[model samples]
Target: MVVILGGSLAAACAAPGSGNAQPTAAASSAPALSSAPTCGTEPVTMKGYFETGFPIAKALTDEFTKQHPNVTFDIREDQFAVITQNAPRVLADDPPDLMRLPQVSELVKNNLLKNLDEYAKVFGWDKWPPSQLQQMRMAPGGAVRGEGSLYAMGLNFSMTGVFYNKKLAAQIGMTTPPATLADLDAAMAKAKEAGLAPIAQFNGGATGGLAFPLQDLMASYGPAAPINDWIFQKPGATIDTPTNLQATQHLEKWIKAGYFWKDVNAVDYATMMSRFMKGDGLFMFNGDWESGNLDKQMPGDVGFFLMPPVQAGGKQAAMSAPLTFGVGANAKNADCAATFLDWVATDTQARTIGVQIGGSHPMGPADAPMPPIAPGTVTESTLAAGAKIAEDNGSMDFIANATGAIYAKSWTPNLQKLVGGEQTPEGLLKSVQADYVSQVKGG
Candidate 1:
């Protein structure tokens, strides 16, 4: 049974049912093949619009083409903000077979995305762990999330945490993951004193990445239920609470202490990752989606840990949710598109690609076999961290996902101001809460 929080949603790994048995195969053994039907041998070209700076989708599509040579992909890429703004127009005017999704409530309310429940049954997706798809379900008209018809699916389930450079960590005499928030601060201070960037974060562009760490801090300071309530648009939900204020103040302190890059307001996501990989910073607040890339670029130089809780031995939390994707309401190749999505979780090769290249756990039945991950790589660490989150029941959806425009409009500018010393922690929460209210009321 899924553990409900805030009377609305479940933790990322918690879902609505039990008795779903796991596959008994070991990691090294070939996965049991699904009996589901494929998209057939018809010649088809799937149109796709994907988020930029992630190669996992492209890699998956390429492999799918290799297996089903008659089906090819015509894909386009854009930054997250661009995709968020363009999703409506593009989905209504010229729809793609599949597209990376952001804040899906508005789209569902607009009837711009296909209802995927039928596809779910066709592909046996209903048999998978329900929590894996819970976030994607919504009521008709998008008034509520976490319950209703399924509309989207994840390429993989991802979790966010602190990823550190092992060499830089050693320089700070940090050999193990920080045990608490204070310990993490001490380590960051040491890195700063050692002439290293403490936190290599991206707060620039319309999609401010600072929300990543801020939300993680919120979880570290308090329970994740309120945050999820706000994101899911539960009645009477608000982000400007005492606990969140404390979380925001903590982030503000980090900003004022020079832990973050001096020019963080000008650095975009790609630039942040590039800088972090170049060993310019001791740690980065990011998701497991980058695990494969970091393992490839840094080898064993990187390590991962959850956002340490405020007190020692306290439960840990992070923004853990699916890397969501959906079919357009008017998609020409809807059946094939869905077949591809189901293949992502059920096919052995596709699951391996998701783990090795996507750096995320494939979304499927509880018993699905995970591809082998080398013992010391960041990917392995992140996967282990995901399991820890499951045990602690401390997973959250990204706070920027609270509303369709919340990230680009409220969080980004407000955070940019916080970085520039123009916004107070109190004011930041107030401004964002106001924007969230306005958007939710369709003002």
Candidate 2:
């Protein structure tokens, strides 16, 4: 995903391009909003914020520089929060040649993003189906609308699921993993009976420790149903609804039952990750991005599965969204940055980099006749099985960054309140609904 600090989209439903056919906007003759080519001209300087740390940008810069020897990649790294605060300021002073944004909603709400609707067509976004606008928190048109343009070319997609220790499961005499909420309950109960910590969560980190779990809850209904009506749109959904109520009470039951480690709340990202990798907790909820680190974290084998739906045969919502890249709205050598972004978005080399490094690209390294993972790592089958679980569920649009934080902030406090026995699900729902209604609608 690409965003120029400025330049812009609106009005009229441009038909969703037929099939995965890439669309070309009518930008051949028009001046590029934020940049132009840098192959032979002034040095193109581009800046970006990387998610998995500086190594990602370092890797991409190395690869990108190899092609455009004249282009200089000026990349920075920060926690997603720092980047969020920095974006508007950067746009206010000078937007970099590029920025890697985590959520689709940022480009939308801040108006710092530049639209790529034209770039999509020129770059064949349809051919790169995963490169389309990230739909995490926004509605269909929200990305282009909020950012004043379609400012990102998304890459590196992942789905939501749970990871667990197979060794731990076997120790409890459970052969099959959980396939439903009941199964999960049984697993939790057994883990408790066997004197295991049972489950793990890095709630103190992000997603209020509920990002993937919330997606799991929503998955039971179908990909779009929960997000479109309940979580995303908030269509005045009531806690009184059986499904909502079930979702509300279900996880809390485990928490109260001593299914979770007591220290989970005290452990943030670093500590939690260390424990997950080193400890004997039975289950973890996270994306595959954690797999490599997890391989190192666990003294025993680490694997994953999709938590089953509450309702049998219910649709599973696969959480996949764009780790969107964008053109800086205020790029100095705008053309060069645009070219670099285009190269990253379209070139096979750039795509392959992501594939190799466990970054987001169409193919996973393990997808082939099977690429080699590190030694002492989990089997490709284990990872693929988890991926297939997410795939089977239908990829739900990821919850965009902006709304994501809202949920994390709101959801966690409310969930803590409910689980700690300070509030009921209905009260929690009303509290959250009021907050969303007030903040989202400015009502």
Candidate 3:
């Protein structure tokens, strides 16, 4: 999982037990309670390992236990980078019933993740839109994705865009969401001129938070297909392209103009969000995962919009992908875990939790009724932006998810260098492409 910054999906590799250890509530290994696994009316404690900083999973688990008193969750939480580094060993040695998964190709290759094909049949997930599950499929040996056996499921489909401080925007005379890249730049310039941080971004720690805005810039300058192809690991795919370079240069311009905080490279995701919420920044490049949080913390003060394209009326695009989780291949409660995954999508209460708590589009059949959102809340705006992205067919997976180690090893460092003036925009893309090529070749 490449950490998506605010709601990261970045992955890293480390020796077993090398990263900070999470507190395990249960013993490392739990015995299988039943040979024939089913979500039976028996006492069950589902062990889950979830990413920290997001309340949706915990909220959903609490609701699930409310509905199924016989079932309960014993969940552990950790940062996304720690989870990425520790995933392999955890899956191999003391697998949880369900866990937040990073990129699944490598895990599927190692058989660490359970194939959910049978669960799809039992839960009628096969009847859902094919595109809903497309990103979770992987070929044999995990050499390719977007096709093959299903290995994971999402709590909800999340999308990324620009989240703004409405009060600050009004101060800068930004009455409406920017309609183009030039418009967006002008808004940022106004914010900066007003002595406000234009973009409160997180580029520090183990995730390259700048990747969020950079990727959005990529979509604005060109089509999302090439970016998706690169992330999906199509043969001969490359990230160092002309359009992307133009995008990179634009981001460099933002940095040069002091749109971001001077110490942005030192601020972690939590700090960035905290500052943004406190009105320290006028804009934030983030995902819908923060919509619910913002709605609660700031109420109607925040607004969201898809990253506008280079020109007004140009097709819009966004980094839209699933908030993926998977059952461990050797889980002691596979049946209950699969049941939980299915419930997240189809159960009315669970789907509502996904929308109101997860701040993402619920993954289910196309006709599934959406939970109502307050007309002017950030969640409503984000969901509306998601609809526009869907209508334009401009969804893309995060660039950090191109490979398991690429986020931590390549993008984060190169992007950090770009921020520090140690790497030029062209050099940043070239260096990342080199690392990507090596990783693709299993270096």
Q: Which candidate is the best by TM-score?
A: 3
Error of 1 at 169 (Å): 1.5
TM-score, per-candidate, Cα-based:
0.86, 0.78, 0.88
**Which stretches of model 3 miss by more than 4 angstroms?**
1-38
**Pairs in steric clash, model 1:** 22-367, 23-367
Q: What is the lDDT of candidate 2?
A: 0.56
Q: Rank the candidates by TM-score, best first.
A: 3, 1, 2
lDDT of every model, 2 decimals: 0.86, 0.56, 0.87
Instruction: Estimate, for each residue in 308-386, the C-alpha lDDT of model 1 and write its tens digit.
Output: 9989999988788998999887778877888899889888999998998788988898788889889988889899887
Residue 379, model 3: Cα distance from true site in angstroms = 0.9
What local lDDT score does residue 15 receive in model 2, on the 0 to 100 scale? 46
Which candidate should be chosen as best, given lDDT against the real structure? 3
Residue-level lDDT tens digits of model 2 in 192-220: 99898887776563445744565576566
Model 3 TM-score relative to the real fold: 0.88
